[model samples]
Target: MEEDFVLMKGNEALAEAAIRAGADGYFGYPITPQSEVMEYLTAAKPWERTGMVVLQAESEVSAINMLYGGAGAGKRVMTSSSSPGISLMQEGISYIAGAELPVVVANVVRGGPGLGTIQPSQSDYFQATKGGGHGDYHLLVLAPSSVQEMADFMPLAFDLAFKYRNPVMILSDGAIGQMMEKVKFQPQRPRMKDEELPGWATTGKTPDRERNIITSLDLDPYRQERFNRKLIEKYQKMKEEEVRFETFQCEDAEYLFVAYGTSSRICQKSVQLAREKGIKAGLFRPITLFPFPEKQVGALADQVKGMLSVEMSAGQMVEDVRLATNGKVPVEHYGRMGGVIPTPDEIVEVLIQKFIGG
Candidate 1:
């Protein structure tokens, strides 16, 4: 099948890809850095073309609940927001996780602690990988570094969300969301047939099957514990089967740079710069931040002298790098906060000052 390639912003590409991937509904509130997601969907009028449902919700809370309702009915539904907005949806996300519903959420992350800035940042690393809500639940987190992956991961996120019966997140930063790049869209697929939905989906009961109900509330402590344990087991299986990362020039490297999302793209250029300066530097980019590719990072720790974790946050993912390395090698973090992005040269300088020269 032929693919359609076009120059598009990451958020717009994601919106288009969802329709092409047969998304049944998109319910979202407009927010900077990611407002284009809903804007594109509304303007393109997917409802007229593919009969997809598009609604501008009153707030982030309402939008996420709408996602839960659509997902409960076994429809491929998604919502997108920036950092503060995503924070508002945490409760709903947790409830969805508890009820074992499938929904795709995209966070076009911006700098934050409280209404920080509209520019790019990766401060939400902890929020996305760790539980942002009240529970032991984990989101299947995919970090996209480019506009292409921003579009590409939409189908993959929905596929994984349904396959594991869990919530999935596309953890993108504002830079990637706003940047223009060439994206190739997959051919459109039809939405799932009504009968093809899982038996657990709340699509009205049939005479031959039990009634389908969706709820996160378990009054009994024992039953809630069991449910939580089941969720843990599922997470373990995901770690075993879904860890994804890309290694660049790692074969003979003495120093490594670990990053994800936009930082990873900058790290790639830093690696090239380091190589020109006669420093054997490689980069490890984690595509799936939740499954984390810990095993791969651990293996590289044995080969490299040290590693530097580059991020737009103060130092979130560096903790994961240290854990993966098991403290066997020195790992340090360098970052710019509140919407400022560190340059490749700045990263290289940190590599020299912290890991190499010192």
Candidate 2:
């Protein structure tokens, strides 16, 4: 039997879930709509009861560096912030990825080119999945569309981060961060018994071995290439195994709408409206943005002649939609930005025009 669920905001759930997941440390600076996350944890029992270290760092830069230190110590850890804070942490995130450290960071993204807005937006799509900071690397970007999924995916983020020895990101938005919904919570999982963490973790060594080192710096070019190859292999495995998505009314529909994060909530409503209007419309929502649900999108393209992308931005994910549709199906985009969420009615109107125009 499972415990009864409760309604909670996505950011609160994330904080609670991270606590329940046995995360040993959390370091972050405040930024809205994500500020509630740090607040929840800071005021909660995780620190007093579980010996977890939760700190509000002076800035995002310091917060992420603290995460690096915790990860190097072989402890489960997490950090949370909005776009501007995330931008500051990008340098640290890239460093964590290069060091092959298992760390989790949650970005409750607000609109931005530079402090564009404090409201929700999916404008960070490319930034989150395309190695936002620098170099040839990718963070496993998980986009949670609901409050339940927000809570549910926090532990999954940590598990995957540790499993691959790579950084993982929960790419959310202000709406999801602030919305309330019923969600069942599960007991924390026990630490893995079969596998001890890598020896490179900065755990103090026994007399039998020498001090271990963990870093991204490799002076030898050949050695650097080898390291890069190993990272690539891990990413490939994730691409094969970790891609995730949800489909609604996609089967037998003539048109498909693709969205993620908070945008999908509106898209879900659009699907309902489209159906009521007798338009054969459906939705494909990507939960994992990096190892994207391209296969599913491609399959849908074979059936649907037209596809439209709904995002909070003018068009970032539209590119991915085009790639998925292979230039065969005509893809369109509709959005609002600087904090305005695209309403379902708006999306439905777009679909009606595109589908009925022909």
Candidate 3:
């Protein structure tokens, strides 16, 4: 049993977790800091043991379309990429959302506007949570702050994907993706059988049943409006049922640091450092970013003097934090962008300077 635990980089753990989660297929293109996900999958060769198919598509565009096809057939499928790669997949992701197909995706994010450096970042918060592509839609986004979560989130994301019949994204960063940590493998799950496929799957049509034609196209304005409304209802359901977050030492704190993914890990350390300085500080980590944990942060506002949103980008998440706090308290934005990671001490001092003051 102990042998099931091993040290792995975040990307490697995510790859192993997918196979153990009974994923039917993975279609991905190589991208820095995230390519290891596909590399590990191909090397493990789960096809023999679990019958999972692993394919390397020629481009991010190709990979996402392959994911669309696999998912439309009711297969538990996934793909992963970094920032620019994810940007390329936007159109297809929107299409899958419109069709209401379930699939998991991991964005091991790096710094980016375009062709950004292969370094850790959390700049894609807006894109991931607020719909990167076209039209009205949302992808349930999970932010993993550690390698263990990189492994743990695969099955969770898959389950939520199927439950909502919408795309689920593991919004990771290069720091987490490349860093090594111990991961205990999940118990292996059996792949879904043909009999277990969902009713809406576009498998071969039987004579006794109506054909399942999966598509995102709706030329009629009235029908397109209906489709949009249905998607809104689904997003509302997710907001009600799927909001996930964590609070540390917030039970009795005067200041709060709200961050996610790699930034959350840094803020956790800052919390400890601030405590040593006689400042009552706590860390609020958002595990599910899409729902944005609005009510939770709003509730926390009454107890804290101020909140600082720390991120690996130029304060992208700060806007959400401000919206969540609802002007009850001052919510300041502090971050290091373009592949730079903020240190624990740096965050502590910034908190004091930003909200505490000399």
Candidate 4:
């Protein structure tokens, strides 16, 4: 455990932490907001110190395929991109999911329907937690609200990816990705030795064992269905065991604000402002957006008069919040889109208008 603290931007911390977490390779193209991830890694020269393989792929599509190759070899691999780039990688992402490959992907999201803006936004929530590509698959989505979490979740993302043998995404945004904060990194871990590769990995097989094959294609329909079922079961297990969230001033509250990533930070301040104005308000921040602390949100629904889902997008996560509440209370969405972040005062005003005004 290294307790030494250092100032670092979110993207830089993420890159450094991946290296420290024993990631064997990173393949990605340059994308705003997250480009620093590769930039920092290249400048840090992890290849010299840890023999980590860092390569700048020609495009997002190429980068994700490179990740597939590295992961197939049983190497800890990762990539980072912004909105448009992530969209370009969707096909490869779907294939990786179908093959049940363990890989870490960081989406430092920006506003986008298509190359919308380079600034931060949470609009990618749907594409992230839901099946972005063509498949009945899910990525373990971790939403980091701070620069510190941007660093901390790197190892955790890789851990979960390998633990479930599936893709894990760190769903951040421009705010967290570019912001600077004090971070204390964990000590570096040694990379997995070639001999330690899983038996299922595509390492050269011995005469005693069968060859390892990694493929998303199964022509047989029944076999493919079985594979899909297995993947669903794994997702259910993740939901049951890995749902994570943070609560602020929820006890005995009459109103609740649900948010994640950068939006949650703004909501926290709004909660304080509401309290000052004699409104009983609390905030629920979903740390794991995929598993999505549904049970907790449902429980909160029983106590609160109304709940508001806040985001830097057009009401994406609000749907999940509604599903969690199950119509138990009046749940509404408030957001600012196109790389615009809502202010705490704005959130407080919305809360008052929707839940408090007669």
Positional deviation of residue 202's Cα in model 2 after best superposition, in angstroms: 1.1
Every candidate's lDDT: 0.94, 0.88, 0.94, 0.94
Which residue pairs of candidate 2 clash? none
What tens digits encode model 3's per-residue C-alpha lDDT throughout 29-131? 9989898999999999999989999999999999999999999999999999999999999999999998999999899999988988999989999999999
**Weakest ten-residue segment in model 1 by summed lDDT:** 1-10
Give per-model TM-scores: 0.98, 0.95, 0.99, 0.98
Model 2 over residues 1-358: C-alpha lDDT tens digits?
3447877889999998998887888999999999999889988967676777899899999999999998997888899999999999999999999998999999998988898888898888898998988777999999999888888998999989988889999999999999998887768654432147567678787798999888878989999999999989988999899999989888878888899988888888999998898888888999899988888898888899799999999798999889988888899998898899888998998887876773
Show how many residue pairs clash in every candidate, following the order shown. 0, 0, 0, 0
Better of 2 and 3 by TM-score: 3
Clashing pairs in 4: none
- Range of the 10 consecutive residues with the lowest summed lDDT in candidate 4: 1-10
Error of 3 at 83 (Å): 0.4
Of 2 and 3, the candidate ahead on lDDT is: 3
Give residue 277's lDDT in candidate 1 (0 to 100): 96
The alpha-carbon deviation from the true structure for residue 159 of candidate 4, after best TM-score superposition, in angstroms, is 0.7
